[model samples]
Target: MDDASDKYRAPALEKGLDIIELLANHGEGLTQRELAKSLDRSPNEIYRMLSTLVRRGYVIRSASGDHYSLSLKMFSISQRHPPIGRVIEAALPRMRSLTRKAWQSCHMGMESNGDIVIVATAESPGNWGLALKTGTVVGLWNTGTGRVLAAFRTPEEIDDLIARHRRAVGEPEVVRAEFDGHLARIRTAGYEKMPSATAVGVTNLAFPVFNPSGQVVAVLSCPYLERVDDLVVPPIDEVVEIYRTLANELTALYGGTNPFEKDLTP
Candidate 1:
């Protein structure tokens, strides 16, 4: 820490923030003793902070009163931020239309600190569809959403994104040469269509959403599932076209150009 900047720190505020950050990573909740041990402090040092957090609705005390986890308050607060709020608001109606047309659930995600964070989603109006919830963090190398986000960036930016990436659990390691080639193909096609790395029997179709500068801002993806029984949906080819149109409409929300109309080679 910088001594000058740290000279007048509020220790209590630091403790409260620390407790909140710790709880965010532990979805199962943590006991007071567990929190203390993780922070290398005594339980008594954090008791008041934890109690305050629970009372204020930022953290939830378990039914047994022994564990603490974050409530939805932080997520609720984050969604109200203007930039993300605008993206979600604009994406939802389009996403709903996409689900209606394609009969598949779709999600919009953006790269944040080298991770793809699903920001908004629309569910299929059909009987069943796979959907990832908002706030889920997915890895860059193993997902169609991640590939589309990286495919439109400059080579240097792509390198830096990979370097800073923290892999999610069960995400496979990347081979730089092969992954580079994969991105090249996405750039060539202006999108990605591949079987999901983590699931069987589903193909993931992803397209880039860009800003006015032609820089990719987010990705719109559909986890495409084919029905084996009597239920029928649009064929994958038609669904891909419908999805690409949705992506273009979203990009237009930012005054972005259509990637299909330009040569994306860099």
Candidate 2:
């Protein structure tokens, strides 16, 4: 380790954070010994850290007193951030407008710990539109918005997210080259569209909201369903155009570039 790095290291804090991250990735609570093994540390080294975390309400200790899991504290704190509030403020009106015109329910989502979490939502004016409620989470490897979010992230981030995704979904390791190929195509397309991976008879149309730095800050997606009763619903092609225009306008307002303008290689 470098001299400067050695000069200021917070060993206790690092152990606490490691515990939080480990629990965040795993569904099952871990016993102290299990945590130690997973983190490659001796159980005695982490016992005090786990106790402090539980006392602070960041980690919950089971009644059996042998296992620990993350509490909702981090999720709660994230909701207090002002930028997320601003994004929701700017997006709600536009999303509501889309619902009226396209007659499809729409939601804004963003990646959170390798999953897409719905942040804002607008229901269709008509009675029969699909809606994914705010706070709902979808897997990184499963949904259209999730793919768009993944496609635009840096290569290293993509790999890390994929690793977490495998843990979250219980899938075998996905070959890196094949996954990268999909992301490259998605980056060129500027969006992702496919039948709903978890639902029947619906299509997911998703686009990214990028910031001025050309980084995606959030995702805008719609669960489109043809209303059999209306008989005048926008066709899928027109729906794509509407979402593209809306996404482009939103991206510009957020001061971000549409990467599709640079390439349509796919």
Candidate 3:
């Protein structure tokens, strides 16, 4: 290779990035031997790379021996970027409006590796409220947002997600059966409403936001207190309708050239 080409190339940097990308793409952590095999490198070479990554806080070793995974450092890196930042910014105003209209806490969440992560949230003005902060992570089987996101997935995908979580959390068989029933209802209703699995005396209303490919990329959710005297508690049917409208509007706004034209009729 020429001197200029040699000057531009950095084999060490490339190898480190390859390791990071592989860990990021995998749903589960990779053992040292697995990483070496995937990267076509020796264990010693992979160990040094992994050590540097661990020191830099880009990766962490699991409690179980020799396995490695990416860390919150990746989320910090994404927060500085414009694309995701802008999406959160644009969605906040609408999220706030929805919260005010329904008199409940509302959230904009996206599926990340089979978990629902809240990106934006608006708190209810009432004294009794459902408080879900941004960055809150919820199980794919427990919440309305989780169920709606799961509804868009294929059976194999859902099974994979359930199995992964079952290994991690050891959810009871009865709970799994109930969640399966919830998924069926979400598929039929085109939306999901369930008593809050994460919080007490609250109900979650969730609907999926589709991209231009008719794929569910995100979810919009409202967590409302189950109180009779609350003026902000809109009727269930109206709340569902409003959520459907908002999801359609968001699809149009972000759909770009691949405009989302999915049938959201419920």
lDDT of 1 by residue, 194-238 (tens): 999999999999988888888888899999999788777799999
Error of model 2, residue 249, in angstroms: 2.0
Worst 10 residues of 1 by lDDT: 257-266
Alpha-carbon runs more than 4 Å astray in model 1 = 1-17, 261-266
Model 1 residue 98 CA deviation in Å: 2.2
Tens digit of lDDT per residue, candidate 2, span 106-211? Answer: 9988876666778889999986778887766676666778778888888888878776663334333456676677677677677877788778999988888888
Return the lDDT, model 1, position 192: 91
Cα distance off (Å), candidate 2, residue 60? 14
Please rank every candidate by lDDT, starting with the best.
Answer: 1, 2, 3
Scored by TM-score, the top model is 1
lDDT tens digits by residue: candidate 3, 1-266: 99999989999998999999799667489999999999999999999999999999999989975789988897787667664575666677887787677667788787666556787788876776776777766667777777888887788988876665421132223376777888888877777777876667777888777766677777888876666773546776676677667776776676732122354443
List the global CA lDDT of all models.
0.87, 0.80, 0.74
2 against 3, candidate with superior TM-score: 2
